[model samples]
Target: MVLVISVTVSFFWLWFIKRFETSTRLTGKPSVIFSLFLCGIGSVFAALFLAELEELLLSHVAFLSPLTYYVFYVGLCEEFGKFLVFYLAASLTDMTKEPKDGLLQAAAVALGFAILENILYSDWGLGILLLRSVMATTGHMSFAVIWGYAAGLYLYSKRAGKNKYSFGMVIGAVCTAAVFHGLYDYFLGMDLKPISFLLDAIVLSISVYILRSLKGRSPYESGDKEAVAEAIESNSNNFHLNRLAGVQALKTRDFETAAKYFKKASTVNHREISTKVCLLFTELLTGSVEEFEAYRTLDRICSSINVSNLNRLRARIAEVFAGCPDEERLLNLIDDLIDETGYRELLKERIAQFDKYANAIAGKGCADSGFLISDKNSLPMAYRHPSFYTKENNE
Candidate 1:
C-alpha cells in the first residue's frame, strides 16, 4: 500500500513533467530520471546525517533567534541535501544540461524525497499521509524549483558562452529556497494561526507560476509550425502521452481529467491544433471558462487558420463541432473563415475528409459567445448578426 501510494503520486507528477519535457531538447532519458529518483531516496539518508551534525553544533553553539536557526540549519541542511543529489546526478548523467532539464530533474528528485518521507510517515495515519502527499510534497518540490532553475540556468548560460551572472544566481537561488523552506517549516512548527497557511500558500503559488512560465522559454518552443514535429524531433517516449491521456478520458467523457491532460499537451506545444480543439471542446462544454476567462484566449487565436492541423482525431473533431452548444459564436467565427468556404460546405468537406460529422446542430440562437471571446475577436464581421452564425466552430 505504501509503495502503491508513492508510485501513484510520484509517477503521476513524473508523467506530467515528462509530457512537458516532450517539447524540450532532452531525450527524457529514463536512465537519468530514475537515477535521480534513486538519488532522491538516498538523499533522505544524507539529510539524516546532516541533521545529526546540525544537532551536535546546536548543542554547543548559540544561535541569534529561533527563526535564524531554522533558516540557517534546518532549511539549509534539507535543501543542501537535495542539492548534493542534483550535483551528483549532473556529474553522473547528461540530464542536467539545460535549465528546463534542471527544473524537471529537480521535480524528480523532490518526488523521490517525498516518496521516501511518505514511507517514513505512513505510520502516522491516513489523514497526515494524504495531507503530506499534497502539501508536504508540493512544498518540497516548490522549494527545489528555485535552486533547480538556477542550476539549470547556470549550465545553460555557461554552455552558450553568454551570461556569467547565472553562477551567482544559482547560489542566490539555493539560499532563497533555503530561506523559504526554513520559514515554511518554522511557521508550521510554531503553529501560528493564519500566518503559516498564508505563507505556505504564497510559496506554493509562486512556485507553480514559475513552473508554468518556464515552459514557454523552453528551447523546443521555437514556434515550430507543427505540433507533433517537436515530439518527433525529441523522439521522447512520453511524446503524445498527454494527447493520448486526453483521448482516453474523453472517451469516458471525463471532461475534468481530459481537460488537464489536453492542457498539459498544449503547454508542450501550444501551436498543436489537435490538442487545442479538444481542450477548447472540453473547457467550453464543461463551462470551466465561465470563471476562467478562457474567452480571451479564444479570441486571441480567432484568426488562426490551423484547421488543417487536425490529424488523427477527425471523428472526435467532427463529433465536437457538430454538437457543441457553447460554440455558437465560434460558429460565427468559422463562418467568417475568409479564406475558407461557407460553414456548411466546410462541414460537408470535413465529413468527407474524416468519414462523417457525427452530430450536427442547426438551431439558431445566440450563444453567449463572449463568455469566452465568441464575438470579441478581429476575425471580421461575419457573425455580428446571429443569422450568419455557422455551426462549424467546433472540435
Candidate 2:
C-alpha cells in the first residue's frame, strides 16, 4: 500500500510538471514517455555504482567526517549522475528547445532518481515515505532546476549562434547544481532538526525562485513578448529575426534581400511552413526558378493555399510559378480562393505581374524583367509603383 501510494504520488508530480510545459505541440507525448523511461533506468544504475564507491571511500578515508563525506562525495555523485542523464536527454532530442522544457525535463530526471531512492528507503515505513515524498524527492528536483535553466539558456544561445556563451553556461550550470545539492545534504546530515528545517525552507525558496524566473523568461509567454522581440531584432542568426526581416523586406518589394533572409530562416528551421512559403515566392520573383525548384524538392509544403489566407496565398503563388506537380490544380484552387474571398481585383493584379515576369524570364531572362535587381536603382518600373513596392511613402 505504501509503495503504491508513493509511486502514484511521484507520477502525479511528474504529470503536474509536464502540464506546464511551454508547447505540447513541440514536445510530443512520445518524447516525454521515452525520457521518463531513460532517466529512470539511468538513475537506478547511478545509485548502484555510487553505493559501491561510497563503501570503498569510507573504508580507506579514516579522517573524513560524516558531514564532509555527505556534502562532497554523496552530494557530488548523486547530483552529477542526475545531471548526466539530463544533459544526455537534452542533447539527444529536441525536447529541450524552450526554457520550460529544460525545467520540466530536469525535474523529470530528478523525480525518476528520487522514485527509486524512495523505494529503497521505503523499508523505514509510511513515515519515511511521507517525509521523502514531500522533502527529499522535492529537494532533488529543486536542485536540478539550477542546471535545467542553464541547459535551456545553452540551447537558446546555440540557436542564436552564441557558441562561446552557451559552452560557458553548460559548465556553470553543472557546477551550480552540484554545489546546491551538496549544501542541502550537508545541512540535513548535521541531524539538527531546527537547523535542517530552516535550511530546507531556504532551499525550497530558492527552487521556487528559479522556477518563477524560468517561467517568466519562457519565449512562449505573453509577458515575455518584448524579450522575444529583442531576441529577433538583435540575433542575426535567429530564425524569428530573419523571418521578420524577410517579411518586412518582402513588403517593400525587395525580393532579393527578402529571399536571402527567408532562405536563412528556412535553413535554421525547415519545419516552419510560413518561412518555406515566403522563401519560395521571393526566389521565384527574383528569377531563381532552378534554385526554387531545388528548395521545393528539399521539403514538400502540402498545406492548401487559401485566398483569404494571405500568407498561404503568397506561398501558393510561388508554388504555382515553381511548376509544382499539380500546377493546374493549384491554379484552379487559387481561382476558387479568389472568387470565394472576393479578392479578384487584387488577385488579377498579382497574376498580371506574375505573367509579365514569367514572359520576361522566358524571353529576356529573370534579371531583365527586374525580378532580380542587384541594386536599388535597378528596380524595374512595374515593381516601382508607389502604391505597391515603394516603402518610403507607405511607411
Candidate 3:
C-alpha cells in the first residue's frame, strides 16, 4: 500500500510537469522522454556518490555545524547532481530549442529526481510521503525552474545572435538555484516551522514569477495558424529555423525566396517588428517600391511600433534612397516621415546631406569629386546619378 501510494504521488507530479511540455508541443519527441528517464537514473547514482564523498570528507573535520552540512554537503550535492543532468540534457538534445522547452525539460528532470528520492524515503510512513510529495517534490520543481529559465534565456539569446551575456546568465542561474536549495534545506534542517515557511513562500513566489515571465516571452505563443500549418508541413515549427532560412536566402541574393520566408515569419508573430523589417527590406531590394511603401506606412500608423524600430526603418530607407536616385519616392517617404512621427529633424538632416552631395556632383562634373561617389571604405555608398559618371567621362 505504501509503495502504491508513493508511486501514485510520484506519477501525479510527473503528469503535472509533463503538462507544460505538452502545451509547448515538446511531447512529440520520444528522445526527450528518454533523456528525462536517463537523468532520473543518473541522479540516483549521483546521490550515492555524493553520500560516500561527504562521509569521507566530513569525517576528517574537527567540528561541522548542521547549517554548514546542510548547505554544503546536502544542498550543494543534491542541486549539483540535478544541475549536471539538466545541463547534459540541454547540451545533448536538439529538442531544447526554446525557453519553454528548457523549463519543461528541467522540470521533467526534477520530477525524475524527486521520484527516486520518494522511493528512497517510502518506508518513512504515509505522513512523510504526503509531506515529501507536497514540499520536497514541489521544492525541487521550483528550484529547477530558476536555472531552467536562465538556460532558456541563454538559448533564446544565442538564437537571436545576441549571446554576449549568455555564459554569465547560465552561471548566475546555477549559483542562484544552488543557494536557494541550500537555504531551503538549511531552514528545514533547523526544524523551525516559521523560518521554513518563510523560505518556502519566497521560493514559491520566485518560481511563479519566472514561469509567468517565460510564458510571456515564449516564441510558440505567436505566428499565424496558416504559417504554423506550413511549418508543420515542413516538419519544423522552429522560429529560429525559419529565420535562418530567410537569412540564407537573403545572403544568396534570392530576394523572392527570402521575402517568402520573411513574410511567413512575419505572420508567425504580428508583433515581431524585426521580421516585418526584414520583409520590408527584402521588398525594397526586389524593387517592389509599392509594397515597401505600404508596409512602411502601415508600420508608421501602428502605435505598437516603438521608436527604436521606427529609427531602424528610417535608416534602411535612407540607405535605399542614397544608393538609388528616385527623387519622387524619396520625396514621398520624407513627406510620410514628416507627417507621421517626431523624426522630422533627423529626416531633414539626411535630406540636407543628400542634396549637398547631389549639388557637389552636378557642379563639379566629376565622378570622384562628390560624396555620392562610392568608396570601398564608405558604407551605404551614397547615391550617384547613373548618367553623372558617364557625362563626366565624356567631358
Q: Residue by residue across 185-206, what tens digits does model 1's lDDT show? A: 7877787626766766787687
Instruction: Report residue 204 deviation for candidate 3 (angstroms).
Output: 2.6
Q: Where in model 3 is the C-alpha error above 4 Å?
A: 2-5, 22-34, 54-59, 156-162, 166-168, 223-258, 262-395
Q: 1 or 2, which is superior by TM-score? A: 2
Q: What C-alpha lDDT do the candidate models reach, one value each?
A: 0.64, 0.63, 0.62
Say which candidate scores most in lDDT: 1
lDDT of 2: 0.63
- lDDT, candidate 3, 1-395, per-residue tens: 65566557656766665555533353234537536855865776786687688879778788878777776777667776777777776666555555666776777777778778877887888877777766777787778778877786676456545573467777777677777777887877677757776776778688777767656654444433333333334334544446546665665577787788777767765666656656666676678857557545554544454446566765654543343334355435544544444443344455566656655555443344334434322433333332222222434
Candidate 2: count of backbone clashes, pairs at least 3 residues apart or interchain: 0
lDDT score, candidate 3: 0.62
Best by TM-score: 2
Error of 1 at 107 (Å): 1.4
What's model 1's overall lDDT? Answer: 0.64
List the pairs of residues colliding in candidate 3.
223-268
